[model samples]
Target: MAFENPSRERIGDILASAGNIAIVGLSDKSDRTSYMVAYAMQNKGYRIIPVNPMVDGEILGEKCYHSLAEIPEPVDIVNVFRRSEFCAELAREAAAIGAKVLWLQQGVVSQEAAEIAAEAGMTAIMDRCIKVEEAITMQGRTRKTQ
Candidate 1:
């Protein structure tokens, strides 16, 4: 069976309900897309867990983990910043960690990864920006600045 993303309402629901977001390939650099996106989500009230092995310390004031498995708490979503070719493994990790959603950033899509997520009973969204979705669904809402 082919993989499919949730409907618009479902997407909005996912955005509204999710709290902890594990961002794979997240960078500490403020100029990077990952950092900016993660910052936005953090401002929107979701906990951002940075998963990147290159530089380890703190990013966006949160401790960075090398992988999803290292996170201590349950993750609601796994937001990937890697290329399409890297998604399948990340999907498996997200499922293993009991994440409810696997979100691929814009311009990234992998049918194999989506299928894996579906088989694991996780929602898979590709080629879409999580930040954009939050802004759309949470319009007119004030984000926390702290």
Candidate 2:
């Protein structure tokens, strides 16, 4: 069977309920898309955990974890900025870490990865930007509203 992304409403609900977002492949450079998206999500009140083996220190004032398994706290969403080819492994890692959602950023899509996440009982979202979704969902709500 083919994979389908969640509805906008479902995505909104997922975003609304999510508090801790573990950003995989997050870049330390300010110009990178991963950095920008993570920055926006952080500003919107989500706890952004930077997951990158390359970085030694913080990216956005938060501790950088080498991998998903290293994050001590529960991760509500595993927001990935890596390429589609890397998602299946990340999906397995996300499942192992008990993440509620596997969100593949824009331009990244993988049916195999989505299936892996779904089989693990997680909401798998592919080819969508979390920052864009958050903005779209928060269209009418005030900043204080969540």
Candidate 3:
């Protein structure tokens, strides 16, 4: 059977419940999509941990780590910005750290990645933009109340 992503409501719940997001392959440059997306998520109250071996010091005022294994604190989400080929290994790392969600940013997807997450009992989201989903879903919830 194929892996299925959680419902939109559940995605919202995951976003709301998660506090820290470890973005693998995150770039320090503002022009980069990874940087912009991570910055937006940070503004939404989620702590952003940048994972990039090329960068030193801080990317977004938070200390950057070289890999998921290096993150000292518990990570709620492991958002990947790397290519599809790299996701499988990331999936294993996410599972190893016990992350709640394994999210592949827009245009990045891997069945192996999703399966790995599913096998490890983690929510897997593929080919989706976390920032877009967070905005749309959260806005819909707000509109319902108003």
Candidate 4:
């Protein structure tokens, strides 16, 4: 069967409720999309946990973990920046750590990985930008108050 992303409202709810976001394959470089997105999310009050095996130190002022399992605290969302081929393993790790959501970044879609997350009772979102969704969601909320 084909994979489908959650509804925009659902995505908004996920982002609104999410506190700790573990970014896999996050880069230390500021020019990277992962870094930019994570930085934005951090500024928006979400705790960004950098999970990059390559980075020795912090990426966005938070301690960089080697993997999701290495993170000491609970994770609300496992945002992946890796390629499609690497998502299944990351999904498994995210599930093992009891993450509430498995979010695959834009251009990174995997039916197998989505299925893995679904089977584990995790909300799996594929081929979307978390930062973009958050921006849209936040805008909607702001307009609703106006």
Better of 1 and 4 by TM-score: 4
Q: What local lDDT score does residue 83 receive in model 4, on the 0 to 100 scale?
A: 94
Score candidate 3 by TM-score against the native: 0.93
Candidate 2 Cα errors over 4 Å, as ranges: 141-146
The candidate that achieves the highest TM-score relative to the unseen native structure: 2
**Per-residue lDDT of model 4, residues 36-69, tens digit only:** 9999988888889999998888888899999998
Q: Identify the leading candidate in terms of lDDT.
A: 2
How many Å off is the CA of 47 in candidate 4? Answer: 0.5
Clashing pairs in 1: none
* Model 3 lDDT-worst window of ten: 137-146
lDDT of 3 by residue, 3-114 (tens): 6778989888888778889999999999999999999988877899999999988998999999999999999999999999999999999999999899999999899999
Rank ordering of all candidates by TM-score, starting from the highest: 2, 4, 3, 1
Candidate 4 minimal-lDDT segment of 10 residues? 137-146
Q: Please give, for residues 27-70, the per-residue lDDT of candidate 1 as tens digits.
A: 99999999999999888789999999896799999999999999
Q: How accurate locally, in lDDT, is each candidate? A: 0.90, 0.92, 0.90, 0.91
Q: On lDDT, who's better, 2 or 3?
A: 2
